[model samples]
Target: MNERPSRHVIRPSGCPGLLRVVQALDGGICRIKLDGGSIQADQAEAVALVAERFAGGVIEATNRANLQVRGIGPERDALIESLLAAGLGPRNPAGDDVRNLMLSPSAGIDRRMLIDTRPLAEQILTTLQTHERFHELSAKFAVQLDGAEALAMLEHHHDLWLSALVRDGEPWLAFGFAGVPLDEPAGRVPLAQGHALVVAVLELFLDLARPDQNRMRELLAEFSADEFVTLLARRVPLQPCPDWRRVASTDGLHIGIHPQHDDGVFVGAVVPLGRLDAAMLRGAARLAREKGDGSLRFTPWQSLLLPNVRADNAAGVLARLQALGLLVSGDQPLAQLIACTGSSGCAKAMADTKADAHQLAERLHRRGQALNIHLSGCPRSCAAAHIAPATLLAVAPGRYDLYFRDATLPGFGALQAHNLTIEALDHWLDAHPRSPLDA
Candidate 1:
């Protein structure tokens, strides 16, 4: 706690970052941000070692497709040092917090990509970090770059989102403010101008926004999008985009074996409740080095993908990942479950979310059900960036209130049942067997 990243930095947050460690009920949590959710095999092992040695070995694959080390006691400094040694820290110390850029896990390797967004993403990330003026931005003020990858996460909302599009059969990137690619794009720019567009938008945001207007949406709340866009145009050129919508991709692309554009395959797996032990990660790292192309990619679904594996060895690699306690197959009930850190970790938790989620997974598994289910510790659905089809909001230690997703209703959709035990939830789930909450 003494080694604060910045003097102006806010006091102990539940939100973890590389330079800062957020304290929880369990201990301090340190988040390690990956470049496009891609890390080398050795880096994965480093995370495993530090998590197991200095912390509680509870490594979480975050919804942002990053890694978080949870349950750190007084040895926080050592853990941080290990991660830094592994080259996981930000480029500059002051730039650490604002380094929030999300790229598709399959950015360059995906067969359906229009452009490889990695180079542009790198430029943006460097600018976000080194630009001292941008340091004032909130850690949650994220920007997503989509390369039109078939395996992309389009549902997560961000302060600024840029998605690749083809205009007149030429590659262009369409951008929107405070929305996802799935939403209509406000404007478009040539692929070459993508980085400049991001820079202009961010600089304009910093210049015009007040202290209270930390996010783009907040600034847009008072100032019209056109007004903001005009100010942005003063810095860089932007073309008006029509009513083109982003093509939706398949759900559950983060599980099992997947094809890559290159001459190989990538095996994906999920961590139960987004938490994993050192052994599991280390085993994955070994598989990545042995069978894959020595790199692993994490996804926004709180899952891990071992990319660049030979297609011939993919089955064995997946089998190895499964043997290491990873949920490789999509049919597993646990694979469909996403849960936040509950009473065992976060002080605000109403239930032991991990334990309760395990019970739910077991019950649903017995009933042969598989749905996108999110189990929040409390009202804050931190485990998921987007609302899942079904949610169980914890009300007590082991009781929950269930809700189904209804686009018409706000906040986790409409409430279905109140104060139901795990067993009762099982029965309710069984009764609604035909619901896609199972599909």
Candidate 2:
């Protein structure tokens, strides 16, 4: 940990953190950010213990590859202290909210990855926390580092994204602002200058943006991205990324057995509807310690991967995960469903989305149809950072409006029905069986 130290100044944010517990309908919630989504077995165990002891034992796997403990009670200070003792806190209090860097769950081990990404990610993360200027970034402002992994989450939006690529046998990083790596890169830089590029981009953003423009997208709405890039070029050398587009890889690799770059395999399982009780998390941690590399990597897909597991033990690991109430296969109905902290937790929720998601899962299970679905308690869509193939937006306690993802449409996409019950939605799915909702 050869990182520079920064001053501690608590920034005000509505988002929950290990130190800042935001109150919900259920109780208080504290988010514990993981460095590139990687957590050790002992750290996982410690989180489980604190959740059970100080909170309500309800642990949520966030869409950003982080974890949050819900229903935290009066022992909030104790919970925070316990987590800080486990080395889960940021280097300084001001660094906590700005440490929002995302990497593929299979970052270092993905067989298809062009670069390992861990080393650069380490440097970037250290700077994000230790550099005081970056502390002014909005809690939601994020950055993504792509190693061209086959199992990457390419759809999620980030303020800045850097992806690995090669040009004439030399490695370079294709970068973009206010969008994902899947979009055409704004520019490119030598691999060695990636860190410098990020610093320059952030500093330039801070210099040009007004106080109200906390996000890159917000600032870009008023200022041209081209102009911003021009200013950034003065700080860091850049090159044009001509006619380069990231290749879309296969999906659903976040579940079940997947081979790593090494001979070992990674066992992945979805935390059913993004909710994990203490027992479930502890069980997964125990399995990681016993059968894997004594570590677990949480994915942006609301799933966890036990990396470096022996290929021979893949089946056993999958079975054990299933026994722990995790959805181990892509075909599992629960695996395809994601719900926000609905009425049962969040005060802003219009319906109990988690409970309804279970009902929808039961209906789909009977029909043997598995589709990627998202149930949001409101339009805020806290559960899904990106648009899902199908979305059930709650209008009332048990009624919802359904939307299918359409590339041409915005928001939730094309609305198909309004104020339909779960049963009615099931029947509608049966009617339009060939809809793009399967995506």
Residue 276, model 2: Cα distance from true site in angstroms: 0.7
> Using Cα atoms with residue i matched to residue i, what is each candidate's TM-score against the true structure?
0.96, 0.97
Put down candidate 1 lDDT per residue, 271-354, tens digits, no spaces: 877888999999998888888788899999888998888889989988888888989878898998888998988889999989
Q: Give lDDT for model 1.
A: 0.86
Per-model tally of clashing residue pairs: 0, 0
* True-vs-predicted CA distance for residue 294, candidate 2, Å: 0.6
* Each prediction's whole-model lDDT (CA): 0.86, 0.90
On residues 1-439, what C-alpha lDDT tens digit does candidate 2 reach at each position? 1111232345567888777888888988899999999999999999999999989999999999999999888887788888988999998787899999999999999999999999999999999989999988899999999999899998999999999998889889999988898898989998899999999999898899899998999999989988988888899988898899998866989998989998899999999999999999999999999999899999999999999999999999999999999998888888999999899998889999999999999998998888788999999999999998889999999999999888898899999999999999888877886777643
Which runs of model 2 end up more than 4 angstroms from their true locations? 1-9
**Top-TM-score structure, candidate number:** 2
Q: CA RMSD for every model?
A: 1.9, 3.4
Q: Alpha-carbon error at 349 in model 2, in Å?
A: 0.8
